[model samples]
Target: MALLPSTRAITSSAQALDLIPIVNSITSLLQALNPRNPNPKNLSSSPLNRFSPFLDPNLVTIVITKQTNPFHALFFFNWASNPNPNPKNYTHSLRCYEAITNLLLHHSLFYPAINLLKKSQKLSDFFIGKIIKAYGDEGNIKAAIFWFNQAKAIEKDKYLYSFNSILGVLVKANTIDLLRTLFDNVVKEGGFQPDVSSYTILIRGLCKKGMIESAQKVFDEMPCKPNSFTFNTLINGFCKKGDMESARGKVDEAKTVMSEMWLNGVKANAATHLNILKGLCIAGRSAEAIEYFRWMASCNMDLDAKSYIVVVNEYCKLRKIDEAVSLLNGMCGRGISLNVISFNSLFRTLVELNELHRAILLLLQMPQIGCSPNYVSYCTVVCSLCRTEGRMREAGYLVDDMLRNGIGLDATMYGCLLEGYSEAGNEEMAMQVFKEMIGKSYVIGLESFSVFVKMLCSKGMIVKAENFFEDICRTFPAVERDGYRKILDEHQQITQGSIKEHQGEESS
Candidate 1:
C-alpha cells in the first residue's frame, strides 16, 4: 500500500497534522484536565479556556480523528457538543458525530460509543451501521439484526448504511435465507425504497449462493441504474452461477442485461462474457458453453487456453467421452495446448470407462498438442492396463513411452510393472523388471513381491526367488524377511516330500 497522508490531516498544504494548532492545544488540555471534575468548574485555571475560541465542528473533527485514544476523543467531543460561555454556540455535524463514533468503535469501546450516540440523539442509520458491524465482528448475528430492525422501525431512511452492514454480515455468515427475507420485507413495505447499495448487497449474496438465475433476475429488475460495483458483482456471479438448468435462454438473458447496462451508461466489454461461459460450464451445460463461446468468437473476442480448458474439464465429467475427445482434438488443431493435468483427468475417466485404447491415443498425441506426458499421465493408463488380463504387453509399451518421454518410474509404477509381468506368467520379463526396480533402489510392495516369489517358485525357480527376497530385504529394511523365508522353506519341504512319496509309491 502507498504511504498516505494522515487521515486527520488537511490535504491542502504540506501540513502533516491538523492545520489548526489549537486542535493539539485542546487535545493536550483535554488529556490533562481534572479527572475529579471532567468539566472543570474553574474556567480561569483551565488551559481549555485559551483554546475555547477555536472550538467548532471542523476543529472538533480534526482533533477527534487524530486521537488514538477514544476517551480523549470523547472528552473533545463532549466539549465540542457544547462549549461553556457559548461564544460561537458550536454544534456537532454528522461528520463530527461519525468521527467520534468511529474512534470509539475502533478502540472497541462499544458501550461508551452507544451511550454517546444515544445521549447525543445522534443514532442515525450511519451510526447504527457501525454498531451493527461491531456486533457482526463478534459473530453476534442476533444483536446485529436487532439493531438493524430497531433502526428500521424508528427511522424512515431508505438504506444507506445499516442495510449494507447487516446484509454484509449475513452474507459472511452464510445466512442468505434470512437476508432474502428481510430484503423482500423492505421492498414490500412500500414506504422505504432500497437504493443501489441494497440491491448490490443482496445480488452479491445471491451470487455467492450460486443462485445465478435469481441474481440475474435481480439485475434485470433493478429500479435504479446499476453502478460499476453492481455490474462487476453481476459479472462475477456469471462466472460462478450454478443454476444453468436454463435450457438455452440464459445466454440471451445475459445479452439483454449487458445491452441494458450499456444503455444505462455502464459500458459492457466483450471480455466480460467469458465469465458467463465459465458459468455455463460450471452448470454442466456444455452445449450452451459451446454456443456461448461461438457467440464470443462472433464478437471477435480472443479466447485463450484457459477459456477452452474450462469447457474441457466440464466436458470430461459428462458421459459423452466422444465429445470430450473431439474438443481435445479441436484444441490441438487450434494450436492450443492442454497441460498434463487436464489430459490426466481425461485419461483417468477414459481408463475407468474401459476405454484404454482411446486413452493411449490421447497420451501419444499429447506431444502434438505441446503437452509433455507427466508421471500421472502415463501411470493412469499403465496401471489400468496392468490390471487387465491380456493388456500386459500394452502396459510394457507405455513404460517404454514413459522412459522415452524422460519420465522415470517411481515405486508405484515399478511395482505395477513387476506385478503385471509376474501375474501374466512371463518369467523372463518379470526378472528384467525386478532387476530394473532393484537397480533404482525402489522396493516392490509386499503384495507384488509375493506375486513375483510365488510365480518363480511355481516355475521351479526357487533359488532365484530366495535371492530376490534377500535383495528386497537389503534395500527395504521394513520387509518381513523372516516370515517370508519360513514360507519359502515350507514350499521347498513340500516339494521334497511329494517327490519322495511318489518314488516310494513307484517302488511299491
Candidate 2:
C-alpha cells in the first residue's frame, strides 16, 4: 500500500484539495480491514498469499494498538484462525502469536490462552515463559511448575529468566519445599547461576512461611552482597512475626546490616527505617517507635501512609486517642493523604468511647479527604449503633446507605442488627432482616436463628416461626429438624406462660 498524504502540509489549500484521493485511499483501506465487515476475506490477501492481511503479525499489532475497536479485530483474528468455514492458508508469525497471547492476558483470558500456546506447533522459549507467567498469575502453581520444567529441558540458556519467574510463582503459591528443591538442585545442578533475585525470592518465601532462620541461612549463602531490598525484606518479615524477643534480635541484626551497608557506601532510605519503626510497634514498644519516627522525620525522610497508620494504630491501641488524633492531623497537615486503615483506627477508637456522633461525622468526612469508607468502616459504625439503645433506626439508615453504595452487608453486621431488633421487640423488622440475609444466601448461624425464632414466637406468630424453622432446615440440611422443633416448643411454652400471668394480673 502507498503512504497516506501528510496531514501537516501540502503547500496550500489547492494542494491540500489534490491530496483528497490519497486520503480517501487510506480511509478505504482501513474500512476494508474493519473486522465488523461480514466478509473479511473480501479484503486483500497477504503480500505472498502466505496469510490473510488481517492475520499479518504487523497488521495484528496495528489492529490492537491503533484500531478503535480492537475487540472486533480480535474476533476477525479468531475467525482467520478457525480451521473450519474457511481454513487458514498460512502459518502464524511469532509476533502474531505473541500479540494474541498479550491480548488474552489483557482480558484475563487465561485458560483459552494456555490452550492456544500448548497447541501451537512453534513452541519458542519466549512463548513458554509467557505461559509459565500466565499460569503463575492465575495461581495455578502445578501448571506453572510443569511448563517451567518443560522449558528447562527444551532450552536452558534461553529460559534462565524463566527460572526467576517460576521462583516468584512458587513464593506466591507458598510451595516452599518445591521452591527449595528447584533452587537447590534444578537451579544449581542445572548449571544455571542463581542471581541476587533468585536468592531474594527464596529468602522472602522462607520468611513468609515463618522459617526466618532458613531465610537467614540463605542470606548468608548469597554469592553476591545483599542489596537494600534484600535487607528490607528480611527486616519486614521479622516485624510481621510480632515476637518481641525475636524482634529485638532482628533489630540488632538490622542495625549491623545498616552499618555494613553504610561502610559499603549504600545509605539507608525511608523504607529501611520504616521497617524498624513498624517492628517496634508490633513488638509493643510504641514509645520506641514514636522516637524512631521523630528521628526519621528530623533527618527529613519522606514518610508514607503505612508509616503514619502504624504509629496512629499503636497510639489508639494504648487508649491514647488524643495522641492518635493529633498524629492524624499532623499527617494531613503535612499533605499526607489518609488511607482506609488510618481512618478505621480513629473510627474504631471513637466508637469504643461511645462517641457515636463524632464517629458518624468522621465517617461521613472520609470521602472528602480521598479515603472512602470501606465495609469495615460501615460495619463498625452500624454494629456500634446497633449495640446502643434507641439507635436501631440509625443503624437501619446506615444499612440502606451501605446497600445504595454497593458495600457488602456481611454476617457480623446482620447478626448485630438482628439482635438489636429482637431485643427491641420489633418482630417485623427482625423477620425482614432474616429474609434479606436468606435471599443473599448468608448462612444464618444457630445462635442468630435462635434469637430470631424466639422473637417471632414471643410476638404470637407461632405459624410464621414454624415456617422460618422449616425454611432454615431446608437451607441447612445438616441441622436436625427435631432440634429446631424443640427450640420452637421451648419459645412457645415461654410465650404461653407469660400470656397466662398477664391474663391473671388483668383479672386481679
- Clashes (backbone N, CA, C under 3 Å), per candidate, total 0, 0
Per-residue CA lDDT of model 2 for 201-243, tens digit only, reads 8899998898888898888778877887887777767676546
The TM-score of predicted model 1 comes to 0.48
Off by over 4 Å in 1: 1-47, 84-86, 156-160, 241-256, 268-508
Best by lDDT: 1
The Cα error of candidate 2 at residue 115, in Å, is 11
> Which digits, one per residue and each the tens of the lDDT, describe model 1 over residues 1-508?
1122354554433233344556656656656663332243553334455445455667778888887667667766776566675576667888998888888777677788888888888778888989999888878899999999878876775445887899899988889999999889877888677888889999999988878789978987989878867876777666554445652445455555666677789865545566667766766667878777777657766567676666667777775677766766776777666656678778888987999998899889878768888999999999999888989989999889889878888989888888888889999999998998888988676677777877887787888988987887888788777776776676667666767898999999
- After TM-score superposition, the amount by which residue 439's alpha carbon in candidate 1 deviates from its true location, in angstroms, is 37
Clash number for candidate 1? 0
Q: Which runs of model 2 end up more than 4 angstroms from their true locations?
A: 1-128, 138-159, 186-192, 242-244, 400-412, 431-446, 452-483, 502-508
Please list the C-alpha lDDT of all candidates, in the order they appear. Answer: 0.76, 0.74
